[model samples]
Target: MKKYKDFVCVGFAFALSTVSCEAKNDAKIHVSQLGYTPNSDKKAMVVPDGKVDSFYLCDAASGKICYRGKLSPKKYWDLSGEDLQWADFSSYDKSGEYYLSVGGKKSYNFTISSKAYDDLTLWAHKTFYLWRCGIDCTEEFSNFHGQSYAHKAGHPDVNVIVHPSAESAGRKAGSTVKSPGGWYDAGDYGKYTVNSAIALESMLMSAEAFPSFYKNFDMEIPESTNNTVDVLDEAMYNLEWMLTLIDTVDGCVAHKVTTKRFVPMVLPAETNVQRYMIGKSTATNYGFAAIMAKASRLYKNNPDYPDFSEKAMRYAKRAYEWAEKNPGIIFHNPDSIGTGSYTARFPEQFRFWADVELYLATKDKKYIDLTAIDTFQYDVPTWQLPASFALMSLIVGVENNMVDGDLKKKTELHFDKLANLLYDRMEKDPGRFPLFKFEWGSNGGLANAGTILLLQYKKTGDKKYLKAAQDITTYMIGRNATGYCFVTGFGQKSPMFIHDRRSTGDGIAVPVPGLLAGGPTLDAIRDCDTYVYNYDHPKSEYPTREYPARAYNDEICSYSTNEVAINWSAPFLMLLAGINENSK
Candidate 1:
């Protein structure tokens, strides 16, 4: 049977080779434009229009075939209607520039090295600094990006008015509060506490998990000389902004700070509108407590901010107490408002995370009792479902024996189940990533899935988990259905037109570097009238909107598909950091 199959494949290749001359100059081959690590599993996806039973890995400078490998059996996927085969070259370990060649098509040049992703990781990390709000330090940015990337400090937000929905006896509707400084939540200029909570935790947790990787990591920010690591320093910019959302009189937290409606597509400083401190909610309060507790623990002994740990913990406890008193208060946008609504209808997930972080910070059994880990769902986390933060943190604590023995066993079991599910998904999918259903912000889901697999690899030292995570990296960089690298400013074919207001209005040819565009989604067609269905291809040959993986439109108006968000960027940064730290 094996010999017969080989004969059939050879015959197919022979018949397909005759028409290979008719192929277009641009072929349907997908590879990681950024390259791969030397010792990792490396494969490229081929569409195989005709004549491709094998592939050659040739040295880019010498034009010599370093390795030749067979293509896997043809497979079909619903994500895109393309028949695909894998070119396995895991045995090639040379460290140099190379390209893949099939019957008549050649891929873009890629590299293999121990430090393949170092520059990507650094550039992506610096995006957080560039996204900083209410700060005027474009000189530092200009120096780093090698050009003038300047914008006036926007949304100072010193005297923000309290809205009717958030009014209390202590802080009335007509009153004002000083709420300033935070990364914009998305393409819009709103600052949402609920969304910022998950974003902040992703950064702080990444720093905690890989302390040595971040030590002395110079991000070229103004705070690089502050004696603290740059990740923590960048996080502090948002942390101080979050601190202003807490109502000191009664410990209630505002849900968001935003203008009544989205401002026009202009630079941050050009939007002249009154910003309001919006509704109060149990969800936002719990989110604030969780982040503050985690921050308190991560910065406990740092020399630069001697009092931050204590002060953060104090506010955390107060916010936690307030949420405990008002457990049923959920947030909804008022009838008059039309900005982004990060509504959290159920507060239990936030409560679970806050309990875990507070327990870790204080070693209090009371907080532990409130966290019902046995009943908690171990879904891969998003801003909407955040119990994964508690699960990941608990596993870290268990490794250090900081928690009880029984709790450790339960966490191990939960994490192991999640890891196995992710591995199975990757093994089954032709794209080699766990993302199949292209919901809004599907690329963010890809990043979170990669993060979990990397963490599992770290905990168990399993090469399978590492390989799965690396495959996800390939998908994001270029090896996928759309044939476009989803990250801006880093690939041969990347998103040049992302749905970011500042990037659109900044008068720059290039969008901000390192921002991950929310990749393809069929759902965007219904939401956006300006989404183009195809790019530089006949509609019959490449139907972008019909397939989930190819549904992306790189238009500035396609917010559902092309927008960049803080929560999405956070886990993506974590995923990139993990790849650089572990792939070596």
Candidate 2:
């Protein structure tokens, strides 16, 4: 009899459970016969417990699973202590795995077979479909004019659900209204989040999220997922949408529907020319920079702008240079390191994509140097500082022979390690990763998304890439489930809830109302059924009006705007489309 010591540790996604211990200290363990239970034992490796049913004895290190007699048991052996071969671990390792914890039951499904690749492609397409236009297949109706107009039905900006008081720092929904009713129809701005940017980003990133974007010689790579791919292909789709608003000098975005001959150069979310949603477009234009570079690289094949690459690079370079030059305003000044709080600070941080975009556009070392792989003065792991950028640098560095084999391996490991290190914070913290109060939703999905993209982009290992997106998406959707219905919906203690931006002029008031669930709130509800104290506090009674939800929250709003209802239920509608579709 061999007994393993009781090891205690958390497994993936912080699923806490107990493992069994079987002790046989003096047994001579021979390496040659290192199969699971080489002994011809008849008795089952049973550990009687309160609710114990079946068990398996196996070699811990080699993953050689064995039953009492010969082969592994047909019954799924609930192995403990992270034994890779506890039950169908090989299958789990081989295929695309999905193990979502529902009602505390750890059920898993996988995609396998030689056609496993095809299956994954199909699965990917299905998911893409789900998110592309949601379950309603509303893609055709989701024209730019629809949502931007707000008054129109089938608006793409459907997720904009905000608290009654959150519109003007808990003041009023609009500048004039003393009460909450009549926003979209009243022609009174019903404040929104920066939905246009994300919508555009989604379109661009979608195109290049898969390996098919790059031409592969050895393997017959699949083609793009068509329109679904374009939805996320931040490179082209997002770029084109972005071009629609680039007449601005520095830059201006479109927050609402406008039929005007000429739109003003202002933050799209915050503009006065349009009598649409009154969203704040000011402060921290820097946040969108990272994704801008990412989209630029992903869609390098086609740039809508004349020398789009150069313009993007120029924008990023000029922006940073300006930030650095305006040190006192952007950074520390009177306080010494002085930026006590990130409330108003617009961090001009760079990621690997930033430098790569510049390099891909112009092979200049000067641009390469701008890729800060070193820590910033006010360094912290959460900021992702230079580490996040390092992931991109690894590929560029290897290509440029900047680092040797061993060094490359180290860089690869460090890149992964840093991501893990950041994820560790989120895992340990119970909910969100360590974030700057002023940072808001920026750090929410970034670490996970960054980690996933980093690993996926570095190595064409679809598992890392897919897993990253799925997990983050799960977190996003889960928030909606018990909360708004998407696991990662709005960050609310209750389903009928909203967040207030406390730090600077910027806050959840900006993102929350704008119909985008965003990275932060999605992360908080990724796992649990409710918010931190949701159990204690009863759910807000359906709100005089409530947010849209996934399979849940089918109830129509008596007062809620169509966009808010859409944002509320979009993620849920999107995630469930597969189960509903595949079942059919």
Candidate 3:
């Protein structure tokens, strides 16, 4: 038998199995394989083949019963079509390794400690460093991410062409521009401004929300010696690249820097394709302005980048001015281009975000006046639904007294309403997450939902909010309907074959660690139909998903279900960092 840390790897013949091999005794029992903090809401979901009522939490080594609890009443969840029972053990606060057993079946081992999420937080954050373009992921990183993870630099955008769609009077088609150093937007090698906006917001917000957690949390990237936290350094690498995408002549920002189409699955060094500065739109400017405004505030007065604050503020104002001039001009790829478009239906969200961020950064009443708060429906943050990011900033601004009484009251009420909605969803759902639709990139939604719960915890010091937030962490790690970790290389049954170009093309057995896969999409069959079956079981033998939560494929071709992305990763890192901070 092979061991994956605490989990035991077993054979391939389990019923309803997605992966060929998983944790030995985890067939009916699911948990956060990385375990929980002593005070966290430690609950395990059980889907037994037979009826079981009681559960025992026992010491892993000694086999002594530490806690005995009656299982919660069986609840049928339509998301997975399973009757799940929860083994509530939140009252047991001992710090030690333990496992749960019900009837005759047992779960994988887990630990109860203050540092349960430390490794996860570190691994998740370092993924940003590994995805960086224009710089070699040097062999020195092999010590941290293993030998197979290091690779030569790729996509030096020094000679990038300005596509006809993005052509300005001064910079026409085929004219060269120098734009470099940003993380790949997703499974593909593109770098998109709209997507990077939310991604960087999540990362910077992590640093802003929990300074003590990241103060000494070194990721050991190349910029570790810069006297700033490594998260800021990693974020700055992408920030610098984004700054280059702006048109100095007109102040409009390009939508993305991408090949005409997605390149084949190959390592970055192996690909030789012409990268172009794609079209620009109002969305790009607002997104860019929002990120720059937020960055200006975060990096202000720092010794390492003394002038960056002012520079960012100036560029932000420029972008905002251009956006005001060219309102509602949506971007579309030209006839020749076929990369990810990232088009938004509701562009006003971007304007709202820039207004809220600019207001928070400058404490100007004019910026706040620009936001249409009465009609604007606050949503969970995604690249498209970005008002949530601005809402979070407003909450922070109000708490810090950045605004006066009237605005603060409005911001507080907005947060309370949104947080209450999430709390209501948590109370009703068996999974304890605010997940309804299993859309593409659903994991990112879960992470953002978890952030809202955690922020509410910060606001009210409510243990219920903390418990609900921890449940989301557990669900992502393992305790979900899929019975997989959903991250690339963490749990015993995590994704080994993510639909990432570098990971699939590198000849490495393991995909890059810390990447959160686009988990459990409803479009799995349509996405994976043409791809090769790389798993041990035949396609026909795989379990039939009657519900959304069971819809996932670990094959490399399952882009909708198994691909990784920056927007997904950023919020997850924030969620983990926030959870770790509360644990400490």
Candidate 4:
């Protein structure tokens, strides 16, 4: 055969353009509950033990009542008007769990599980529902995706997978951008890899997690059934096709899948640059393989869709092997994490939805430990860093089936402290905390907050988690923008923990500005209380594109499966499933 590898090397520029490794100093910031923030996690001052009168949350910083709600002396009491002593809601306890206020019954008695805020669980449910409803977010995204795409229970944003920018411009550019900068379907910004992989897995997860929906196609192939299977099918096709372009290139996804649109473009996989194809870019390809492996593991005897599991596993293994060898930038390692451009150490831990499937399929210890987060970091005498990876590490310990007993305890405590702190921030200022706090935005940020809270709830089974989830959902649904959330700023800096060490002493990571993805946020809020969204969020005066429109950031067009597939569509599908299942 004429050397196929020769064509790739000649056709593409097979080199990476990494950001200069000039030592970028990490930012020094103060957050309480990094276990022992000297000024942070101190207990709130209280009245004399014998006294019983006013019930309220007193903020130590301001020495004022942050919030006041009636309480009962009982472990779980009724919401009686006469009751006055209320337990203060704080992340100090646990998160992702919540309770409903039942009249004269249980105060904190209404328990929502830690998984109440789970991204995978809730979004999977929503995406399934959207699939059932027949108008997926991807269809809506096409309005911003530049080119139109067919939509039926879809991960609609799929068609534009490699497209650079889904341009939304002029005064119509609306929010999600700074000064309504020229919108390029190829050039706005976002977190591509992790979020997209999660979304991608959600597609398979719908089929696997709730076989009734995805696998149901085998039985009740409806006349108009174009579920995410189509989406994934196409994704696989495009993915395999894209491999042609990647043979020599170090790290980069094609500009777009459309034959015409991105025929001549490819860029380095920089943060906020090339379409967001983070760890999942490679991880997704592998994850798909893993999914197939899972299907194979399950369907080995079933002859119908026989090879899916096997093929999927093979693909996953190959991808993993490639990642180990290439080590392309992302959560592959911790040292490079704050370095930006996507990095997470030991993400295999905490049962990341993707890793979880593979672990479930193979029952591999290594994969489970992929979910393992390092508690050893806790022993290091340093500032408490609570990045997503750290959270994963904490989760690993809490869920540890294997590991030294002491390490497990230490891990659980670490998570406890983190959860407690997050809870406090949520209660204190659910709006401002978490930078990616529970709010309106296209970044699927609220979904992130919701998921994190749900993670906490699952861990501790504490009522505070339910409260956090409830509060976030309450705030979100109360705003009701027809499931669309908006914010300002896309191009300030990577939303991850590290701040820029810009040589110019003045220009730090400037915050850009606004739009929201309808899928993820709605799914997240729905996880807590579906009743919250009686009134939907309106279509923005400006277009849905340009969400979190940061001034200086570049856009990562189609590679962002988070915005397109998983976060956007999976939630709808999942929600639909929950609705139908319950209604049935």
User: Deviation in angstroms for 478 in model 4?
Assistant: 3.5
Which candidate has the top score in lDDT? 3
Instruction: Quantify all predictions' global Cα lDDT against the true fold.
Output: 0.81, 0.29, 0.83, 0.30
Which order, best to worst by TM-score?
Answer: 3, 1, 2, 4
After superposition, the stretches of candidate 4 with alpha carbons farther than 4 Å from their true spots are 1-195, 201-305, 329-360, 366-372, 375-418, 430-443, 480-565, 568-584
Q: Which ten residues in a row have the lowest lDDT in candidate 2?
A: 27-36
Off by over 4 Å in 3: 1-24, 144-148, 531-542
Report the lDDT of model 2 for residue 7: 16
lDDT of 4 by residue, 543-567 (tens): 1232222111112111221122234
Distance (Å) between predicted and true CA of 422, model 1?
0.8
Q: Which ten contiguous residues of candidate 4 have the minimum total lDDT?
A: 28-37
Model 2 whole-model lDDT (C-alpha atoms): 0.29
Evaluate candidate 3 by giving its C-alpha RMSD to the native, one decimal: 6.4
After TM-score superposition, the amount by which residue 430's alpha carbon in candidate 3 deviates from its true location, in angstroms, is 2.4
Per-candidate total of colliding backbone pairs: 0, 47, 0, 101
Q: TM-scores of the models, in the given order?
A: 0.92, 0.42, 0.93, 0.40
Candidate with top TM-score is 3
Candidate 1: segments with Cα more than 4 A from true spot: 1-27, 143-145, 530-543
- TM-score (C-alpha, index-matched) for candidate 1: 0.92
Better of 2 and 4 by lDDT: 4
Candidate 1 lDDT by residue in tens digits, 218-266:
7888878888889899998899899888877788888899999888778
